[model samples]
Target: MSLVDLSWRNVRRNFRLYTIYFISMLVGVVIYFTFSSLMYNEDVVTAIQNKDNYGKIIFIASIIVFLFIVFFILYANSFFMKQRKKEFGMYLLYGMKERQVATMVFFETLFLSAISVSSGILIGGFLSKFFGMVLMNLMNYNDDISFAFPQEAIISTILLFTLLIGIITIQSYLNVRRVQLVELFHAKEKMDKPLKFSMPFAILSILLIVMSYYTITIAGDTNIWNDYFKEALIATTVSLIVGTYLFFRQFSGWVLQKMSQSKNYFKGNKMLWVSSLRFSIRGNTVNFTFNSLISAIVIFAVGFIAVDYAMKGEVVKKEFPNHFAFSTQDDETQKHIDKMMNESHPIIGHETITGIQTEKISNRKTFFSYPEYYTEEFYLFPESQLNAIVDLRGVGEKVDVEGVEAIVLTRGIDEPTKYESHQPEITVLDDNTFHVVEKIRYPLLSIPTNPGGDTGPQPSVLVISDEAFEHVKENRTLSSFEIYQIKDPKTSNDVSRKIYDIVMKTEGAYYSAYIDMYSIDTESSSLILFSVAFFAVIALFALGSVIYFKQLREATEEREHYAILRKIGVGDKEIKRIIRKQLLFVFLPPLILGLLHSWYLLYYTVILVIKDLPSLTTIIFSVMGLYVLTYLIFYVSSTSIYYKIINEKNRR
Candidate 1:
């Protein structure tokens, strides 16, 4: 038979062994194609308000996806080479030239790549509309998403994957060329040396990991954040990486060593898996460590992004209380804005917010116990006006400010004012003392607090009784703002753009429009969620597939050992039990460590950013549950395959 025919026959004969590889490659293709298609989808481009920014972000992300695909394919190629070394050796023994063997291996890769790429593109095309609808839904868009396979996306997927396939085929050819006859036939005989546990390394690994966690926790402290934030972040990252490596290399070995010395080491079926694990620990340490890090990253990324997407609306509302707000609005400008706004959207409610910007309040206290870095310009409002505004919005509770009493309102939960966490008696104008009676964590007005310079005032509000306000306003000029709540504010982009133009022309004028911010934020958030969710899924399944195949390789190598155990009267049930225990040890540690690591990361970072987010616990748990479920599926599938491989009856 021709070399091509032999290659095809070999693929068909070993189709079962190639199942995981085929599935993995197909998954990679689908992920890459789906993202590429979206990047060029005309409907998505037209719907997104900021196409340029989104284009840049998706392009960079696409590049990352491409690199990941290349890496995954190359890694799978290496695994395939190792698995088929004996087969290639037999072909050489039958007088097949080395060049012919290499050529045949290259043909095998080509066949698989052709099948995977075509199948992946077909599946991705069919699912593109569903994914598109998901993106639009996440962005709160109501437009219908029509299905069309963009030529750009298809071309990109084909070309990129072609390059990747070519690269892996070359790698396989090189691997075949370098393999010696003896090395090929005895490839499975090569074993990792037994690991020796060191007391110092084990303790050091624990200490390093603890130190890393501790640093991340304290990194949020005011003093630490100011002085050593960068250093702390670097230390935390490096220490965690080194610590995880040492943990698998040293700590795991020590535990297994202690287990082997225990009296229960010989307990029913424990000897079977334990002895096997101890024998393989040295080789498995690096794999476990790598997989553990990947797991942690996937969990942290998906968890945090999920929380961010879920809380987008709440966060936007908190940061921007009014649907339309602007400072320095005069009678004529208000008439013009009113006319423009009313033409597109009906105004639900409108309020003229009059307040005084004073630099007289003192004794500002913060939750972090540190002085703020901005000039404290208190935007003082009377309790009555504040109450009226809140009542109009129908959101926050009204506060009563008695004599010599004041209430502080901050921008939001995240942008805490200088005196946000504590209420202290403050002296206005250096003589009149006002006691802080209450504090509200809401941004009643969208003032340009610090406009990114060294001079502007920080956004802060102090609500005092009208009597106290009159006393303090002895010679101060009051600032007026126009706040409007509009109907269907999300659909008011055209009016917002016009109003924005008028506001920009007026000097010392600033406006915050709901549609302006909402469109950008929603689109950006949706893209982020889409991109990150894809990566999370691919990372989880791809790594899980790698682990699955790794175990299969181990099973194939140890098939003789299991047959010997069977000859010694070990029943099928007991062997299956042993297989379960062995696979459990292989799977659980990485997942548990990954969960722990991601929990700490989210608690320190995402929780702080979206503290008032609803159902945060549920979001985190749901992400982790999905991760565990994926691993569980892989674990079960691997166990079944491993048992089958080792228990198969010998055939001639």
Candidate 2:
């Protein structure tokens, strides 16, 4: 048969073995094409706004996806070479020239790459339009976004994947060229990798991991040095990656040694299992370590991305309590604001819920303190007005501040100002001291009277009683704010945009203009949402496919051991039981470590930013459950296939 025909037959015969690897390649291409197509989609870019910014981001993301695909394909190529070494050795024994063997590999790689890439691109084309629409709807974009087939996107995707395929094919040929007769037959079984455990390294890894968490927890929104925040972020990431790797390598070996020393692990199947698997575990150390690291990353991405997605809306609501806020209520300006607000209301699919007007009784600075950290802010409103705007629910009984007493408002459950936690007294504008009697963890205003630099005041509004406010006022001119709240805000993107446009046009006329919650969903949150899905796809691809490749490779090397065990009068049931224990050993470490790593990170992160948003935790656990379900599929398949391969009948 011709080289092409031989290669085609090989692929078809081992199609089952090739299924996961093929699907992985296909997924990569699909993600790449979909991202590229969206980048080129006119309607999507236009509707989402930030056309140039989104374009740049999408282009960068597409490049990243392409890189991941190449890495995955190359990794899969290595495994295929090992699995086929015996087959290639057989061909050489049959007098097939080395050149012909390389030719066969080249043909196989090319055929498979071509089929998978083409299929991936085709599917991605259809998905791009659907995803585009979904993204627009997610941001509550009201524009008429039409979908069209992106010819350029298709061309770009095909060219990129084709280049990757060519590189891997050359790789396959190179691998074939290096193989010898002896290597093809016995190379895999000659494995002897030592388990080198370092106590110092393990301890160091733990310290580094803790340091990573500490860095991330502190360098959040409240950090003093904003410029160095990026440095802290990088340090945290590098520390985490290095730490997880070192920990995983040590963890696998450490478990084995402990099992050997302990009586609990010395009895029954544990002894047989642990003793038999020691060398196997040692040889697969790199694989297990990489799997744990990957698992941690996937877990982190899946967990926090869902948390961010859930808590973003709550944050938007807290940080921006009003749908639109205008500092000036000009008859002409208010006319403009009202016209824009009403005209675009239909487009945004929202109706006005309430409009709150507050006359700031002079720029009054409010100061509050905990032990070490003290926050100071400037705001002007009477207790009645402030309480009317913000629903201040106290933990204890709400006593009306009679005379000189004051009530403070702070957003976030992790707030230092929570009534149960803080005794925050306030002094307004540096003179009027009001003994703080109550605290409320509630929504408040975001706009500043003097919106200046990063170090400028991030003041919290103090709601003092009428008597205290009147005494402090002393007949000073006060700034004012008119905020409009809206309902069914998912449909309010257009209205928000309209108000922003009108207010920003005469920029000097207004103190600040922002459409609270939904505005962010359109611009910033859209990108974040897309990123979550992107990371999720990568995680799922790794969890669902890469494990299959690893298991199958190890299974081939382990076939003889299972056959021997079966020959020694081990029943199918007992064999299956052993397989269950073995698979759990393989699956549970990465999973449990991944869970702990993600949980630690998320717990610290949530405490820092979200404070009391329970939904964030709920969403994380929910996503984890789904991830485990998918992971279970890999475990099940690995066990079933391992059992099938090793249960070969002894014919001696």
Candidate 3:
């Protein structure tokens, strides 16, 4: 009878149509609330050693999630408004004023937002603890996280959703006020405009995409990479973006146009779906392009996170082969460290190597310049002591230095010819010189002789024969280091912390404790992996919803056409087949393009850093398989709903 009653009744009648949209909004709210809660969560801040840094990361991720939720809500609202244009027209024909109809629309939005937001916040609060536990478990932490519902989080969620609700209501009101009865009734008949095809633009799109891939693949090998890497990267990204847009806008339409002209266009019901698909693609080109790009990003992100998390241990081990290492001048401090470490954890291997610190080194006529530490002052190690430590770690290449020849150990130099010129002659005390023979990138020590201890680039070490090492050690003031390999060093954070405190107290002391770097990296990487995974899920959810809602809207528009086909002797089976072909055309292209883009992108980027190609491939394909499975679920769901809508109209 009244506007409120009419709005409520319409909502109840159309509840089935709103189910997917409601669920999507509910999940978006839950994700937003859960992540926002973490920003101010006391449990997370207290559990993590660096509270400020953790808060900052969660804050930034929450903002991104919030923006995505806004986009999703607005998108779903547009679909709903389009679907109900006829209903609004009927209301206007029944003596309802435009302002009154707009009010009714506003009430409907308020009702849905109230139900979804309240229920979502309630569910999100309970689920926050589960996500917290997941984060802790991934980080290898054993701390128990208690239930916490931050008031700030609740207030923020309420305020943000309230603002979103206001925006949705305003949009609905404006749309209703501007609609005329004839336009509203005929809105669904306004089909997409035909595409203007051009062969040159289509070919250019393919060429641009190829050029972008070529640039990225050769980025590491070219002088352009060394001089203008940033510019090259920007150019590659721009080209890829433009190329993808053109592929969807021009190339896809051209192919459809060619298909229409071929004999295959009239093949049993092919025209039914093919013609529909052309129109759909023409209208949805921008949407399809965006979905393709987001899908690619999600695929690459998931693969990268999985690979990075898997290879973190190997990376940590390469950087920190020794369980504990420190350089100290005092013998008493070294003894105390050994005693303390031995008391806490059993030392599996230990070595006290003597090193000579000297600045007398010079080079001539080299194509590549070495690091300042390599050319200026550096540590000199005896071949025997280095071999002993190498045996202790059971890794790294041992050097064989003869006479005045020396070996250089460093990393990050890839070109072999850079070290072929006149080798550096290490001049020690009393004018002694050793010619450098071979260069290696193997990491053998933690400290880089810089102020950051083990944080800088791997420092170069000069390895010489025992006879030369002795001569230099006797003449120069020697630096002594105690290296230890302990059992289960990753689980020995407390012991590492105590030892770090002791080592820091000694003046001119440099140390590397495995647990410090390992735990921090583990925690940070796991958090990143979790955040990236959540983002991928959200993006996938958006992609699926976009297609699903779009299909439903089109189905509503084409119901009359299907009814006519049925009356003219078109069987349900043939119509269903047409539906299947039509929906597949919409669903399959972006997914295939996304898969190819991600595979190519990861091959050039993540695979270089993570060299275990086979394992990385397995992980990447596994993620893609899961993505495909999820997408198929949406496809099947959309097809079934579409058929049901058409069947009901045919029966009527």
Candidate 4:
């Protein structure tokens, strides 16, 4: 037969086996295409305002997908070669040269590659549009977005797979050339068991896990300096991941052996399950290590995303005190504000616009070294509490002290106020009179704000007294527009609209503004939604890639074992059940670990992000619901692919 004819006939004969392999390639292609489409989306591009960044994301994602594909092809090619070894040996025995047999294998690989790559590209193109719509919905884009097939992406994907196929073909040819005919025929036989490790390794694994947990827990503590804590956490996490794989390698078998020693080994296919698990853990150390790392990445991403969403509300509320106007200093807007407020609703409280600017009077050499004029804790006290303090101090007259200004400092001022502190001994050079007044604590309406520098909002501090306010008029402007606190924040919008109309009617009333809670709430909701969706995608990608590769490796290892089982009269259905059960064990540990890790991390991260963390029940249920649904989908998909592989082998 011609080489092409022989390759075609072999493919037809083993179509089922090739079909499983084809599906995996197709899925990988679809995932790549979907993510690429999302990265290049016009709406997403506009949202981020960085189209070049999307290019980088696509390139990085493509590289990752390509690496996985290369690994998958190499692994599958190895297994397929091994499975067909007996056939190759027979061909050699029939006086066909080894080179001729190698040529046939090359042709077979080429044919399979062409069939799979073509079908995958087509399927991927269709799925890309669906994924685009899903992405747009997730991003809350109202604009029309039409999906267009990326010819460049398809071409690049084809080139990538072609390169991988060539590499696999050459490697397979080399592998076939080296093996003896006898060895090739006997390739299905089980090899000797891997040697057990010493007890020290087990002890080390436990220590690493403990140390990793310790690092993660302490990483965010305020007591630890940021750099030291981050470095330590990263090092410990890396060590633990390495240790986890080693533990699974040497200690997993020891634990399974112990489990088998007890009566529980007989329950629920425990023996089969344990054996299958042990084989998997022992057989694929690299896979397990990468899988654990990927799980960690997913958990961390989810935690970050959840915390980010939770904090969005607080951030928006703080950044914009009111929905319509963030800060207003215009005088003309004051009269318009009053008219709007009177026309709109019963105002709960009203205050005129006021501001203060302070200059250093003490001639402090360094800015940071100067004592804090006001601290956040002291500023949070309410006016009633401050009045009580004032009453308790019982100062009927201001105490005159030499060289020191007696000032009654009011708490909760948004900006710094200028005043020189006077000691009893020091005399002022300027003719400015000074009196020693007690600092009274008072609360200003503490808006949801962060006080930690530019990273977050800072609390406002005020030093207010009629006497002090009059003395500090060196360069101060009079307070302008009034603020009316409405009984309902919703009324602010209506008030703002009325004020806008009033200002338009009145001459020189140039700027009128009102802030409502609704605008802030909407902005917060949008931010939270985007954050949640962004993190979710990242988490899904990390987890899915890990599971995909793990399943691929596990399936490869079991191919020969399943073939041997079929030879020994084990039914194909039974083999598939074993495969399914094995996949369950492989998937469950990481899923459980990821969920637990995500839960703990999410709690702490959110606490730091949101001022008030939600109840434990709420957090737990939310995480559990998301995790369970995601896990179920992944588990079903991974196992289905695995069973398809096993069934194909059996039919062959």
> Highest lDDT, which number?
1
**Ten contiguous residues with the weakest lDDT in model 1:** 449-458
Q: Give Cα-based local distance difference scores for all models.
A: 0.79, 0.65, 0.78, 0.54
- Candidate 4 Cα lDDT to native: 0.54
Model 2, 1-652: lDDT tens digits are 8998998998898886577567767877888888788887888876654566677777777777777667777777787788878888899899998888878877776777788778987888788888887777666666665555588898897788778867877787788778779887887677556465777877777888888767766655455337776777788878877876776666556666678779787466676566555656655555655666676666677667666665676666665555555555557877777666666552222221111123333322233333112123345456666545544211123336767666666545324343435544555555666666655654345533221111213345566677766767666656565656544545655555455556556554333323433444445666766766676666556654566677677777777877877778777888788878877777777666666666667666664567677777677787667667767888898889877766543443
Question: What TM-score would candidate 2 get against the native?
Answer: 0.73
Q: Order candidates by TM-score, high to low.
A: 3, 1, 2, 4
Q: Going through the candidates in order, what is the number of backbone clashes in each?
A: 0, 3, 0, 17
Q: For each candidate, what TM-score against the reference?
A: 0.81, 0.73, 0.86, 0.62
Runs off by more than 4 Å, candidate 2: 94-99, 129-149, 191-272, 305-312, 327-482, 497-507, 511-518, 543-546, 647-652
Global Cα lDDT for candidate 3? 0.78
Cα displacement (Å) at residue 405, model 1: 10
Model 3 misplacement above 4 A: 1-3, 41-43, 95-99, 126-130, 137-148, 193-246, 257-267, 301-314, 327-346, 359-377, 411-421, 448-460, 475-478, 605-614
Which candidate comes out best when scored by TM-score?
A: 3
lDDT of 3 by residue, 1-652 (tens): 8888988998898887677667777887898988887776677776675555577778888888888888888888888888889988988898888879778877877788778888888888878888888888887776777666788998888899889888887888788878778999999998887777789999988988898889878866778867987998799888888888898888887888888899878989988887887787767777778888889889898888888887886677776777888765367866777777778788899888878777634542231244543434567888998889889989876777788888776644423322347776656665877787776655556632221123543445678999878767764788887788997787677777677777777675767776666777777788788888878877888888898888998898899989888888999899989999899888887888788788778888888766754587788888899889878999999999999988876666
* Model 3: lowest-lDDT 10 consecutive positions: 447-456
